[model samples]
Target chain A: MHHLRTALLGVCLLSPLGAHAYSVYVSSEKDNSITVVDGETLEVRQVVPVGQRPRGIALSKDGESLYVCTSDEDHIEVLDLKSLKVDHTLPSGPDPELLALGPQGRFLYVANEDDNMVTVVDVDKRTKVIEIQVGVEPEGMGVSPDGKWLVNTSETTNMAHFIDLSTHEVVGNVLVDQRPRVAQFTPDSRQVWVSSEIGGTVSVIDVAKREKVHVITFAIPGMRKELIQPVGIRITDDGSRAFIALGPAARVAVVDTKTFEVEKYLLVGQRVWNLAFAPDQSRMFTTNGVSNDMSVVDMERLKVLKSIPVGRLPWGVVVGP
Target chain B: MNPAMSRSSDWIRILASLSLILSIGLVRAEPLSIPIGLISAERAEYIPLSSLEPRIEDEGLEGARQGILDNNTTGRFTGQSFDLLPVTLTSDQSPSDVVRDLIQRGVRLFLVDLPAADLLELADLPEAGDALLFNIGAMDDDLRTQGCRSNLLHTVPSRAMRADALAQYLAWKRWMRWFLVVGPLPEDRAFGAAIERAAKRFGAKIVVQKPWTFKAGASRTDSGHFNEQQLANSFTQVEDYDILLVADEADAFGAYLNYRTYRPRPIGGTQGLVATAWSGVTEQWGATQFQRRFLERTGRFMTPRDYAAWLAVRSIGEAATRTQTGEVSRLRQYLLGPDFKLAAFKGVPLSFRDWNGQMRQPILIVSPRILVSVSPQEGFLHQFSTLDTLGYDRPETECSIR
Candidate 1:
């Protein structure tokens, strides 16, 4: 099926400007490098060596700088998008695992797993703003689209902490399932989806009421429930569809946002950890840690197009325009 | 209307309003306190054969402390507080006396790290009738079966569970034949019996069974390697087998069988590759952060005993947080109920088996350097949870806790 799609696209690619040329950056945890693939061609473009235990990659607002969380080094390495070189370091607290940008992309919220605190960094000024004390082993960070709230999910504490951006205080705490790994807010900021890796459920919390409105569960026939660990959630901009990376299950669950039900499960590489979307949202890229590869999925068809080999322990990924 | 009647009514209303305010103030002044007692009896320390194993002084206690820290992190939001009151008993001290004192001090939750005998003694104490006890050290299968106590819940995996976990993995790898070597200790024989049971349960065959009668020489002596090598080779000269299963719970000769066997067969059970609830080699499913936190707190690798103790305390914490009460009966009911599940970085939510009071958890199969696999292995199905395949299931449970 992938070959047939490629052949059809080959005939349509006669025009030079037929597709968008975005770059996908994947942070390899073991190799200490970033695997950059061309989004248009779906091929490995470069492997840029970075700091130790690089994870949690995110593109800047202007898409000029890419922030990489060097967890072992205890800092965020800023890579220049064009040069693919480390520009400088930002002071992140100990063992930063996952990160998110503020609505304006002026500040970065990093979940410091070791310290149980979320460190907010002023990206432009390259200075620490303040460290907000959160639950134990904070790993997920999500900023509300309206810029009013930031949700950080702590894996051990098993709670989604809603922080008020204005005061930077935990305004509300909603207990989710066990080992909550990722938090993603809806495009309209009405609800936030939190994935519990060990509990094997995704909790959808209402923003206004600060309560769990519904829980979306995944069930692939013949798959053990323990293997279906939900992690690394990506919701579309229109809030119509959501893709959840099921770790160790080696599948991405596509959910219909309106119904909060699983639409389909697309099989991918082994141990898919995190994912990214192209600038145009037409393609998706997933980092498979055990396979040491990135799986490219066509957004419209919800099909895995190909698996491109990457560095060892591919962890986090992001796309740059 | 009479003035005297109106003044009497006003006085009643004022007193009622004042009492309401006082009750509200009292409620605001105190949070629900869940005090857990950790009672451990001191035992003779055995020097580990390998330098990789560090001698930890506060094994179970440190894990309970970390559990308190984790519980309080979530408790701060739920208007609850958790405290661990630990008492380590000397050889001369009595566990019954400790339980009496703790019960008098209003501790209804206990994490017991004593041997099976001492644990049973504490549970039988009249003062502990209302207390809920969690066994963190003992692994005797009989405790979960014929010797089961209605009040006792076990966090440590039983001998049968560990044996069954290993058997499942071996069956998955098609290593169906095992050469069994049993040590002289009673605990070793019990473990050997469990292996026999597991072999029958998992469709494996024990090709040859031999008892290890050679008394180990002074291992620390300069020329000890010569004696150790000969002893390991002499007893392991049996017929060909897929693996050598050693039952050495006392750490006597299990480590010696590695690389010194007559054949090049892999060693398993209490030796080369171990089936345990936790290990240093486990780093998946967010366990790296769990290990890092433990190392940062104790400056040592978390052991199996530590993980068990942590689970015991966290189970209570989880129950308290969910039920919003510290009452012994209510908490116990909530724990054994269907809604109780605690995550211990094992890639699954662990809960108690209502039939046997044993925790349903996946067992880790690990070597000295890396994790081999986790069981219940694939295709080992249970009507309820696949984790049940690693231990005694409901139908096989001899415990009847009403």
Candidate 2:
């Protein structure tokens, strides 16, 4: 499927403007480094040292700079893609765990895990636009495809807060499973999937109704139910399939988007934390925290192709061209 | 029939039909009320010389209250309503009597924060045979071993668990040489024995063992600072050791050992780098959220006992959510079964040890200002769970109850 998507994307986007190599960037929590891996060869390209306690990573729309959340320093550092150096810092509120950029890449929404607020930064102005108070320990941030709403999931509050982009206010709040870690909006913006690490379930919320539509639970053969903690979620561009990173189970569960049923579980490295897809969508990279490595999964084969060793406690991954 | 009488009868008929439909809807959507009972002593006696420790009027009860709020928040969507029936007993009152009253009132789930003897008294009642009790205050290992009850689940970490957790960190640091200093109490001696067992289990050595006979002097008073340094330094004179592991369950003379010892060694076990369930300094793995919630609710930091109690109540809520029933028997069976797991901000899903009914979790080792580490340290592997390495595993269990 991934190969087909890449082929289709190549045929549709084949031009001089589309010719660019892809690289996967991973944030290592303990080692304080962002490891760069070539998307095609699956090799370590470079290891760039960043600030203290770097956990979340996001790339600019044009792929010129990478925004890294240095949680301990209570700020977000921008790394120049060409120089591979942190050139500037954004004043994100205390303890930013994860972040999401607006569709147009004008504003950056950061989840301040320690402060329980979402800091929206106007990227062009290089200033914080607003700090919206949210539920306790807001960690996951997601923006709708249409750029109308942003979703923030609070860990202890157990609610998915929907903030309207225009008003910068929480428009709707949907109660989800316990300890929601990641929220991902569907490509159509009709639904949002929030992964609950402690509840061991994924809550799919209907955006229009602002309520939970389905609760997807993963069950792996010979694995304990508690170990099936769903953390990172990624939906295919066409909204046909979803991949969920099961934290301690060390596997990625593939679910059919239409039916909401789990199709397969692919074994990965130890303590998988987050997932990212290559620009071409032909492969997925997973940060395995315990194994201190990243697993490359072939999207078409639905199998782990290789595990490349990274920094200590690899947390989040992002792919850019 | 008269025209006026017929018009009035038509209006009455419409009103009667609407009322019947509304009554049916109410019956169909009736919420399931799950009542949990909390029993603890009315007052917590303050320990002298600890000026930094604030006087918390309600520690365990406040934590359970927060848990109740959390449960109701999630339970609102699941059609479950959780109610906490907190019954505080005076020193003169009998704990078993309260247990009987709560059982009669339809509270089959309980969180008890009493001493070991009082907890046993409540658990051994005939009327409470079917009740599920959660031990949140007592850290006695016997409760999980020989004295384990079929109906009681201990959320508190046993002394052996803490000892093992600290031992793993010490062993990982290559601090194999320990100077064991025990206080003058029976419980302290038992804790000393647990430390000894941990040293043997983790391949460490207790270079010297001694008991502190000096009385705990008063703090911030006359003669309080007099002879304390001399006494502690004289008592700590022994073979060179990497750390001084104190077994002071009574809180007597342990705090004095820090900075007053003859040799410069890090004090651990009961002081300095102590292993606990929750610490004020732990901000990782989303604990900041819990700490913030707790601080907002109670206006203070959450203690270990409070976290244990909170976990106990949340366990019931999680079980109810999973089973979708408030029936005590079904919930008990499901919780004791191998399938039950609760997420309590410990970075892992916490579950019960089926053999001993002890909640298996990661013990946080913290100093005064920062979180030192969490143990069942690296390279300590178990065939089943790494958390089982900190406590009594299946093979080491004397608990016969399934």
Candidate 3:
């Protein structure tokens, strides 16, 4: 049973079909390109050009399709992993920054940074179906697995807008720290952690009760809030740990999920912005902006194992099974 | 030695070693002391030498420097210190040259008040990659558009930044119709062109363009001087223009067009509805401390040049505080990080464009006596700040500085 569990966890990603089908995808806001790296080799494989000022990336739950939000394009590009071809474009809100797929994989929620609106698109149809207006500069979005709550963050207001998936109505509003971006839920959906990029803190909120339970502030001071701006947040599949991308620190912070405490810092390349973990859970990769590289971390040791030079200003990453 | 005594001595040695190791551990655990560098011109520019024996000018730079000093002091109780290195250079020197020279001096954060070409020159030098340039001057609107560079960060308001401010208020006032009056001087023409661009960008109309000619306290052979009624009657044919925009940069005619017009209308030029780099009224509204510091330090009034100088120094402090290292490379990383933002007296925070390295923030509008308003209006908002809405939107930007 022990071997079986390990095999299920590790071999799931080593499958013959999923292999070579999709490389690691990352978005570069500076170069306006998406870099793909071979998951197994951890080597930069290809660089594909995209719309003006590309920023956010989202892979379909099935891992066959990936969606990229271009800030200047006012549209989302859908890519088919099998053919590695640009599938189509869907009209999006202006200046899209971050996005996520709904639990059912039927819809994509795009955070339009400039328009202060969240655009919802039906993935199958590749069409924008609904536009929900939020606060100023709406960015970073996540939906509960049960499709009960849709939470989005407003950077300027430093608050989270929570809407009911069923009613499509704003359920409640909770103030987080300053300039909140990027959010993630625990495996069981018991908690939601949102990274306040400008505030340099992460607010871990209770999903069921919809309130902030704890705020993880970096112990160091004098570091500009920009240096502590937390851009990415990810929880382990087992919900035992969480990882946050520290923008100016150029590294990833490991937090123990149970204690809600920052456990350690794993140094990456320069200006680490966003990251993703391999499906096997053996490694995690981050896009380093200034260094123009991708940092591969050996998760077991909680250290940056290697750095892969990539296209200019690598800002987003998504790993596929 | 006795056996018991020898054992005691050995224990003491071990304790000493342990204590040494523990102290080292404590030092590492404590917060780090970081160094920051402020790079500017080691020499000054000749700006027509307005005042006698004028060595210091730049009020805007002074305001920015004071803002950083005040903000960084907040970190003292929290354990952060700031050190500034003041540099000034002549126009003959290259900005990249100065930037490299400062890197050798342990300077990595740069605040710039230079020509755009000089700013782009930062990319040519070998060590230029190591430092961050905070742009505080050279208000060409194109810097945020086609001329953007990643190595440079802008804090000083661009011409468009100010124009956007003017547009927002004008739009709110429903002053859609405009009567364009242009002066001949370069400064006058440039300002008028910017105002015209803003008029179009914010849904305004240009009913007519009137050319004004004056020799600065001298005119034609006629005996008439500062003819208010004749100048006002120039607009008699077109009663359609709502606001008369004078672009008399030479202060030749625009200064008097206000209220002296044939009809009761708003006159905006070098006088009414004007845009400038820095305003004296800025002394109020959180700008008092900046004024105080400049007066205390230099015993003179602050100028726009001073604001640029201050922003240069402050950018270094911000970068140094974040990376907690005096090293140039680390400072660059921290300075460009998305979380890296700067707050100035302009009442908003400025952040760098990772692609272009332009500091994006608000631009203030000042009437002769008061700070009238800020651009993009309160309602115009972006994901970052509503103040950003006034400047170039990401989608409209053509700066491909990656």
Using Cα atoms with residue i matched to residue i, what is each candidate's TM-score against the true structure? 0.91, 0.76, 0.48
lDDT of 2 by residue, A66-114 (tens): 9999988989999998899999999898888899999887799999976
**I-RMSD for candidate 3:** 16.1
Error of 2 at A246 (Å): 4.5
lDDT of 1 by residue, B113-196 (tens): 988998999999988889999999999998987788889999999999999999999999999999999999999999999999
lDDT string for model 3 (B247-297, tens) is 775455565566767777887756687655465567422355445556776
Error of 1 at B348 (Å): 1.9
CA lDDT, candidate 2, residue A52: 95
Go through the candidates in order and give the C-alpha RMSD of each one to the true structure: 9.2, 9.0, 21.5
Itemize residue pairs with steric clashes in candidate 2.
none
The candidate with the higher TM-score, 1 or 3, is: 1
Candidate 2 residue spans exceeding 4 A from truth: A1-178, A184-230, A235-272, A283-316, B1-30, B48-50, B395-398
Please give the distance, in angstroms, between residue A244's alpha carbon in candidate 1 and its true position after superposition. 2.1
Residues A1-321, model 1: lDDT tens digits: 123234335534653675546678999999999988989888788899999999898888767789999999999999998798999999999988899988788999999998899999999899999998889899889999889999999987889988889988777888898889999999899999999888889999999999999998889998877789899899987779999999999999999998988999999999998988876579899999899899999999999999999999999999774
Looking at model 1 chain A, which ten-residue stretch has the lowest summed lDDT? A1-10
Worst lDDT window (10 residues) for model 3 chain B?
Answer: B70-79
